[model samples]
Target: MNFDERRPIDILETIGEIIEAAREENNLLKLEESIDILSTLIDNARFNQREIGILNYFLANVWSYIQRIKFPDEEFPLETPELEKQIIHLRIANRLLKDTNDNFKKCQIQTNLGNLFSHIGRFSEAQEYFNQCLEIDQNFEMAIGNRGFGLYYYARVVFDATQQFIFMQYARKDLLNAIASNQVYNEAKYAFAGMVKQIESAYPLKELNDFKKYKDFYKKLDKKEINYKKWSAENKLFINPLNDILTESVVAHDYLFIPTMILKSDDKLFFHSMFNQLKQEFVSVRFLFYESVNSPKPHFSDKEVVLMDTLDYSDYSFTLEKIKIAFRVCYSIFDKISYFINIYLNLGLDKNRVSFRTVWYNNLDKNKGLNTKLLTTKNWAMRGLFWLSKDLHEKEFDTTIDPDAKEIATIRNFIEHKSFKIINSFNETWTKKTETFEIDRQLFYDKTFKLLKLSRSALMYLSFLVYDEERKKSIEQSNELTIPVNFLKIKDADKI
Candidate 1:
């Protein structure tokens, strides 16, 4: 029967009739007809908001079911383009829920979006959406589990030769989160066990230790009366030194030994280069940590520790010295400039009403101006600046940048001298009131970090430039001194 001929009650009855007919036929053609009838009813404008939402949900389900039947394999076609149609359908469903302020509706859309993304191998994005769904309704156990599973699956896809270590770390986090939020103990247990198996298969050497840890976790959950058997059946235990050591070290700042062999005389240089590359890598990692703070995930404490330890053994002492020296020089310049600006120009010395103009004008009054105390205070300021610079520089350098001893020393001097002038210029142009500065503390912090990060980048680039120049000159003069690309590896020490 046509939708126009039906009353509101009749429409409801018609929907039920369509559903029953579709189910009774159990045929694709009849199912399609039922869906068409529902669509026509939905378009009639007679349905209220609730009915529209329900009808849309039903339509989504029908589409999902059809897709499932057409492509039974979750990993069908392998090519992303083949999934474009499915993604489009999912997107349509998601858009329909945009105005759905109800938490349940939001959860439904997010869950479906997550599922669609996961199917297409976009696990990270899928995990994010699934987590959103869970946040709206923590009791939505399926979404919670899917979020974790998505992370695990995504980790698997990216767990190739280049970044296997990173993948394993992420995998561990996803699996752990999945189990924690799991409602059914069997589900959690089984997922956890499966992860343990994957870990073992991927990394065999440290299997005993890894298995022991998983066994301990499993036993704890089992003691709590969680489904131990299901978990045991699903997951096999295994381990690797990298994962075990890294995880332990990160979670607790404990040291761990990572074995290596020096195959060539140039191994040290390679290690040094790798060390330098890690500065940017660690920064990126830190940024990721910041971005992923909202997610139900674990911290990369082990990865951080591994990176830090690796740096420590890779000429960390020299790196710190270089950074400290550079910082001291930069601070000296800043101190001198700040002193002139504050005491001579009277820029920042007011206890009551402070501003650049007032400070400058006050400094013009010789009676209220420059004194031993003022100069001494400038030195103290210099020391503070020096400390801040040194701390940040050391952190960045030790974690990321590795330079040759001579080159590092040169860059340190260059930055100390050059950056001081830059800071002086920037400060000289300071027109805002001191009160304003205090009011916007976050702005100041952000600006400070930005300047420091920029200065660090410049210093790194200049160091490389100097090295390149030296290499070119040497080449022209004679081939006696062959500088390696990575300063650290110029020695016969070790490979990264």
Candidate 2:
């Protein structure tokens, strides 16, 4: 962590920023990492009361924030041991700062407590704390937004339209007031954006004639001003969209059809690299996917009901081909990187004295080849990619496998092993409650696409590292690389 090189507060602030990003992005890896770092700091750092209080506050609240976002429709009853630990941290922070006169800090704790209470359906206790925060300071911008968000979340589970309308009316007002109180604060803007979304698309409140006035809150402004689209994109793409999660019967209607890239059109490297053949193959698969989505065969009446996956592909053979090719693509990427690193490791050695060919011929673990043991398994390969590209230790990166993405390893394993385990057998049924040997095609395609995307991203990133390292080695050996006439590319015959 280079802890001695950085100030303690700077480290703490960085951790706080990471935690906030996790909440905004719903990144479980980032959230878990921020918690681990904070927990370590609390146990190890010799901080004073205020710093400790701050650490405890973050340790407690970040978990609650994630749970609230992940399962907003239901109460996060503080029954789980994890939630209980967060509550303990909040309680510790509360007691630590009780004697202090930090109104803002006290108000934050109060709001957090209110949030926990509301999550557990203790509405009266939740209201008491929110009212206490407002009583502490009527203009506390965060507390104001907190009340608005709390109301917005509460309105999710409430049934009556009249009750929802009333709660939303107050929420919109509090969110607006919070923005007015702090024009530059991101929290206020985000809360205001949430309020706008709920009024427009999230809930069926359009018929409330009185609620139409709330449309002025967003106004005919530029789309970027409210950043509603940006928030929605973050919700889906940052992590997997969880709208249908937290329920077994959820029918996912949202899908990333064709999975377009967000890169600029002028970025030639995506299509013009030495691995252009594999890139084109991947793109071909995407085109097949596009065709599958647009194809029509069956028609159903409005009365008909059939369980269907929103994200699906009809081209099963081609989908499997894409996955197998993605594995080869991932292997090629690490192989190139490993080759360059091995070259760099032998840079200063005397080839004539030790016979570089002898070292090269040996199948060392670090050898840059597909068959090398450096990252023999898919799990190791995933972790190894980060190590090659990043200057940080593997421990420092948030490297937990996403639940959806973890299936990538199993599919890859079955592909490498040619096992029918990828498909369920009749014996694998869930105690005969459902049909046996059913394949979750949605899960298969989703995970395979994840591996494809993961390999591409890691390949592109490590390619730059390989290019620069080889360039550095060429320069060290006093052989300047020849530059391409048109594109100004550098090619060193001596470099990998």
Candidate 3:
């Protein structure tokens, strides 16, 4: 019973039960003690990945319960440190569970991750996780129901009418499926049915676009086209979850426009062209990254590979360089998005000074938080971008979602302006004594892939922010002018 005096394994055995009892008896003191004991065990004791994952999952659940107790309101998304703590632990648990074969635990962790993401207004990521849960076990009622429930709430916040209506239809379908599954809890089933009814009443079936065709084309085909499903367990380092995130983000970006507004100009074409170019750059980077991962060996015949007259043969190869290039390009895309933001918002901030990391802050005083003009826009996508920017900022502005944000920035800085080494393995001696930044090659790849995902998300948010503003402008200027703009499709041969 004295957990403080028990061995790590012994403590792990009893900790879950102790926490459950604490929750059952409403014993906050006991719960707090258990949390401390588990944290100590995790940090001090030797354990396998699975054990660590188990401990983290329990800790995350405890935090979740504690936060729910502290904040009983169900209307607004939670942004508390406690909630963030839960998310952090759950993410760790998910990563640790990746190689494990425990479908039940994977389902639980992924479902909770989805739930937490939804709780924090990151509905797209949440939906992706929920979809991942379904991929693991098709009959997972929690994920099934949560997806429907989350989609309903997500639809409420979406600004675009067509997208909103499409999401409502999807939500209705999932809710109905959840109800039919017969495994969902009664309360959840009631909620699902209620959402379905609301969707039906708000957007009638006849008024909506063909949901089947839309779903099949957009949702189903995306994963296949991304080719991430082919990434195997053997290639764990190459299997980035951000691949899914980026894929889903493209869906969001494309969904921003619905072809109803009749006003256009050369400026619109220029902006659209710029957006297209940025997207192309990102796509090329992602392709190179994947190709580097898939490459069996460096090809001597390839013109790109042969042109390297001065090559470092010290554990260096073209594949590695490709990865580094991808990382550099992906990181640069963030600044480009920031540049777009600067021009679009017309903040008149110095062109050189504006950056993704600094654009959201006040020109004079970043300590004042988000910029005044940004705050006034009240665009959800813009607000999301502001928060996303915090993840890349200094510790004082961190969002707690990415603990490695500072390290990532440091890596990017080192890559750009200083010495950065991506070794196959960690060299403690060199890493500790040398001024050069060194990271395990796998870790470097992971970070780069993450940067790519972040860039993709930023691009999506930028597009949606423009859509939100444009929608508002159309409403405000309804009586002002009517400009007929014609659309012409570019041929596939001239697309580039």
Candidate 4:
């Protein structure tokens, strides 16, 4: 542990060797010691992006092994801050290695990210990370197998037949592909074997004609017989385009809109309205963001007063203004989702005090973790939203899902209460303590886009959470004779 005379890279390598040896020998105590040293090194040492990435990647792997060693008899706690530390480390590694030339390491980090998210029951994000891994290395067996494995769990928890069938068919294909690859991974073979047994034991899905048709539909997609782009564009569905950065997120969001019949209830009306509002707000923000990036001219109303003191003249443009609006509005949507949770769940917290960062806890006590209502609901999507909220909260010195979460939070605060500026230059000269939080226009734009993706995920999770609850209600009240209620779809002509 004494690395006083060693270079940072040397220290990192030493720790990696120690951790690997410990893992190979099953030395729990030595592994725990290696974890502590690596954490200390990460906190205290100064290293370039590549070195730090390697360090975090090693730490994440060691922590995963430690968790399995410690909890041999049970699944890792789905909502624990302790378990999320592994996620934080892997995400940090992923961000740091984003531009690295090492394709194998890139694939590894992404695969670990997917695995952690799946282990914690955040299957939506898990699938996205897996998709990202496969994008980097399409034939990566681990990513393929893990994605299939995650989908099986995802299919189990979901209540819709369409979702279940789609996930299972894809899962089967990925698992088979993983198994049939030239270099077979043992884990993939094990997963496929386990999956086969489970499906064969409970072979009810194939009996449904509707689900059988869904399998064929997926086959057509695989065979390229169906033009997905044409189908999606014609139907106005937000399907994933190939190689899109937001492909998985878009796919997840599209699935949330699949038609489902629910009995009429007062809460249903309110929930539906909130879902609509969230969707509209998200779409508006998304449009404004793209418009800002794509617009050629700055449009302004002549009636608006031009005050020199009110603007940062250094980089003043309508595009920047539009981007700022998108960022602020996108940030607000998270709190609005929190408001929805408070009212819908009847948490009875003070309405004005509810926040996305604090709404899930009992009396804002994060130590108590999520409230009993959320825990009892048994909805994975709701739990996923709770975990997503953690990414936006102020973590002091801790690592958040977004490496720049603290700065993003500061920018949001300044935009609302003080001054926030977007400049072309971002260098060491800018002080963090300044009243104006200045950032480069490109960085600001990137963060805003990231926030939009996060907001999209939050909205999707909210919709699915409601869907899960509605399905549960229908099942519980199956014998009740409820009156039929019809709802009309909002056409393009109905847009405001």
Top model by lDDT, which number?
Answer: 4
What would you estimate as the lDDT of candidate 2? 0.48
Per-residue C-alpha lDDT of model 1 across residues 1-496, encoded as one tens digit per residue: 6566667766766676666566555556765676777678667778766566556656655655554555767534332222433344344545555566677766777877787666543443455577667667777765765555565554443323434445455456545555665354685658675875676577653532343233333444444223322321221100121221123312221111111222234334332343344333433332332233223443344234433432211222222333333334332332233333353222446434332122223333334633343243322212222222222222213321111223333334544443211221233223233221111223322333333333332223223222333333444644343433421223325434
What C-alpha lDDT, on a 0 to 100 scale, does residue 175 get in candidate 4?
Answer: 76
Candidate 3 lDDT tens digits, 1-496: 4556766667677888888988887766777787887787677556678888989999997886676566667533323567767877887888888889988999999998887766654655677789889989998987888887887876765665665776777777778888988678899888888877788888767864364332322455566444542332112222222233233323322333222344533335555666777877876776787787778776675546434432322246778788889988887878788888887777777888778767877773466666777756656667667656656745345454666777887887887889877777566777884568888877877888777666766666666677677677666745644565454545659967
Candidate 2 per-residue lDDT, tens place, 137-229, comes to 777777777677767765543334555666666667667777676432785587577675766574454453354322233345575433432
TM for every model, in the order presented, reads 0.36, 0.32, 0.75, 0.82
C-alpha RMSD values across all candidates: 23.3, 20.4, 6.1, 5.8
lDDT, residue 200, model 3: 80
Ranking by TM-score: 4, 3, 1, 2
| lDDT of model 2, residue 111 | 80
- Mind giving the per-residue lDDT tens digits that candidate 4 earns over 225-268? 24443333232324221111222322322435423555445325
Instruction: Compare candidates 1 and 3 on lDDT and give the better one.
Output: 3
Best candidate according to TM-score: 4
lDDT for position 330 in model 4: 88
Task: Give lDDT per model, in order.
Answer: 0.42, 0.48, 0.69, 0.71
Off by over 4 Å in 2: 2-8, 17-30, 61-82, 148-176, 183-496
In model 2, the clashing pairs are none
Rank candidates by lDDT, best first. 4, 3, 2, 1
